[model samples]
Target: MLPTATGRIERLTLPETDQTVCGRIALVFPRTPVAAAENPPAQDLVRVGEVRRICGAQLRNWGLERFDDSVRLLLSELVTNAIQHGSGSQVGVRLSHTPVEVRIEVRSGPVNTLTARDPGLLDEDGRGLLLVDALADAWGVDDAGWVWCVIATAAHGA
Candidate 1:
C-alpha cells in the first residue's frame, strides 16, 4: 500500500514477477487502489490514471517523452481491459526500450483471451485493440496473459 497525497493509505498489492524484457526489468502495481476498487463505476478510469502517472515518469526518465501521448492512450486501453476482464488480483506493467523501439507489456493473469473484433462505425465499444493496432508498430498477447506492444522510435541515431 502507498500513501496518497491526502495522507490516506491506499491499498495496492504488487506481486513480484521474474519476467524481464530485453534486459530491462518489470514493475508491478495493483490494478486498482482502495477507492477505485470500492467504487466500481470509476474504477477503470481512475486506476488507469494512476498507472499513467507512473508510466509517464518512466518515459520521461528514459528520455522518451516523444512517445508519452501514444503510450498513455495505449496504457489506458490495455489496463482497462486487464482490470475489467482479467482474473488476476493485480496488474503488471513493464516498459523497456531500445534505441529504435519502446516496448510495453500489461499482464493480469496466467491466461487471457483478447482479440480485436470489427466494430461498426456507430458502435460504442470494442475499439481498444484496434487503437493499439493502429498506434503500435507491433503487438500481441502471450500465453501468460501479457498483452504487449512495441512502437518504433526515431531515437536510433540520436
Candidate 2:
C-alpha cells in the first residue's frame, strides 16, 4: 500500500531536458500555528514520519527502492529541521530523480543563518546536517532559503 501525505502532494512540471526523469513528488506542509503560543504543538512532529513514508512509497513506485533508506533518512532530517527551526508557516519538500541521482529540496521561510555545527559527543541534537553532509553527494542552502541535497546513485549501480 502507498503511504499518505500529511498535507498535500502535487505533480510538478519539469523542463524538456528533465523528461527522462522517472518521477517527481512535491509535498507542502503548513505549520499549524498555535493560538497565542510561541511554538508548534508536539503533534506537529508526526509529520516527520508521515513524510518519510511518503518518500519511501514514491521511491518504490519509481523502481528506486534501493534508495529508500538513505532518501527517507535525508528527507526526515531536512523536514525536521524545517519544522523545528523554520520561521515560515509553510514547508515544501520536493523529490526528483534522474537515472543516476536523486535530488531532495526542502524550502521554508527566509533564514539568515543556516549552518552545520559539530556538537559534543553527549549532545543529543545538532547532528542532522552532519548526517546530510555525510550521506549526500552535494548539499547547500540557496539564497531563497531552500536546503537542497543530491545523492548520487551510481555507487548503487542503478
Candidate 3:
C-alpha cells in the first residue's frame, strides 16, 4: 500500500518490466484504489499543476529557462490526456534528468491503445500528441499505458 497526496492508503500493482529509453528508466504504477472503482478522485489536474510548478522551479535552478515553456505545455498535455482517456482512477508521473536529457513519463490505468491523430484545422482538441511530438526529442507509448518523452538538456546548455 502507498500513501496518496490525500493521506489515504492505496494499493499499486507495478509491472515487472525494466525498460529504458534515452538513458532514463521507466516505471509503471497502478491506478488508485480499485475498491472504490467508480468514484475515482479528480486529482489529475491538481497533480499536473503541481508538476508544472515543480518542474518550473527545477528548470530555473538548472538554468534551463529556454525549455520551461515547452516542458510545461508538454507535461500538461500528457497528464490531461491520461486523465481524460485512460481507464483508471489514478495517474503516475515521473521525471528523470541526466546530463544530456530530461525524461518525462505519465502512467495511468489500462488503456486499449495510444495513438496520435491529426486534428482538423477547426478542431480545438486532438492536438496534444501533435504538440508533444513536435516538442519532445523522443516520445512513445507502451502497451502498459506508459507514455513518455525526452527533452535534450544540451539544447538549453544544461
Candidate 4:
C-alpha cells in the first residue's frame, strides 16, 4: 500500500479532454502472492480509489498523467473477476509504464473457466472479456487461471 498522504491531498489534471477519445486506463493482472495463503481475496480487494492512485502515480512518475477511464473500468472488472471467479481474497494488482506501453496484472486464486457468452449491448453483467477485447490492444486468460490485458501507447510496444 502507498504511504498515507501526509498533508493536503493532491488533485491532478488530465492531459486533455475529448469525449471521442478515452485517455487510457491500463492494468496488469498480478501473479505473485499478495498475501499469505490463509487469507481471503476480498480482504485484499484493489479499490477503485487505490487503482486510480496507483495508476496516476505510475504515470506521473514515468512522466505522464491522465489515463483514460477505460483503464479504471478494466482494472475494476478484471480485479473483480479475479475475486469473484477465484478462491483467494488477497488479489494483487501491478502497473508498469514505459514510454511506449502500459501493462496491468491481477492474480487472485485459481479458477475453473474463463469463457462464456459476452454480455449483451445493455445487459447488466457478464461482459468482462468482451469489454477487455473492445478496449485493450489484446487480452487473454491463462491455463493457471490468471487473466491479463495490455493497452500500448500506439500499438505493439507492450
TM-score head-to-head 2 vs 3, winner: 2
Cα lDDT tens digits, model 2, 113-157, are 568999999998899999999999999987777899988987779
Ranking by TM-score: 2, 1, 3, 4
Model 4 residue 40 CA deviation (Å) reads: 11
**Looking at model 1, which ten-residue stretch has the lowest summed lDDT?**
1-10
lDDT of 4 by residue, 7-117 (tens): 222223334344433333433333223333443344335454566667766666655454546667777778766655555534556555555556666656666556646
Worst 10 contiguous positions by lDDT, candidate 2? 1-10
lDDT of 3: 0.66
lDDT score, candidate 2: 0.79
Error of model 4, residue 34, in angstroms: 18
Against the reference, the lDDT scores of all candidates come to: 0.70, 0.79, 0.66, 0.56
lDDT of 3 by residue, 30-127 (tens): 34443323433565346567667776676677666777898889889987776566666556666666677777878666655567898999997888
Give candidate 4 regions above 4 Å deviation.
Answer: 1-46, 120-122, 156-158
Off by over 4 Å in 1: 1-25, 31-41, 154-158
Ranking by lDDT: 2, 1, 3, 4
lDDT of 1 by residue, 1-158 (tens): 12233321133443444343332435554554333344334644576787787778878888888889998999888888777766665667777776677888887776556679899999987899999999999999887668999888854342
State every prediction's TM-score relative to the real structure.
0.73, 0.83, 0.70, 0.59
In the order shown, what is each candidate's alpha-carbon RMSD? 5.8, 4.7, 5.9, 10.0
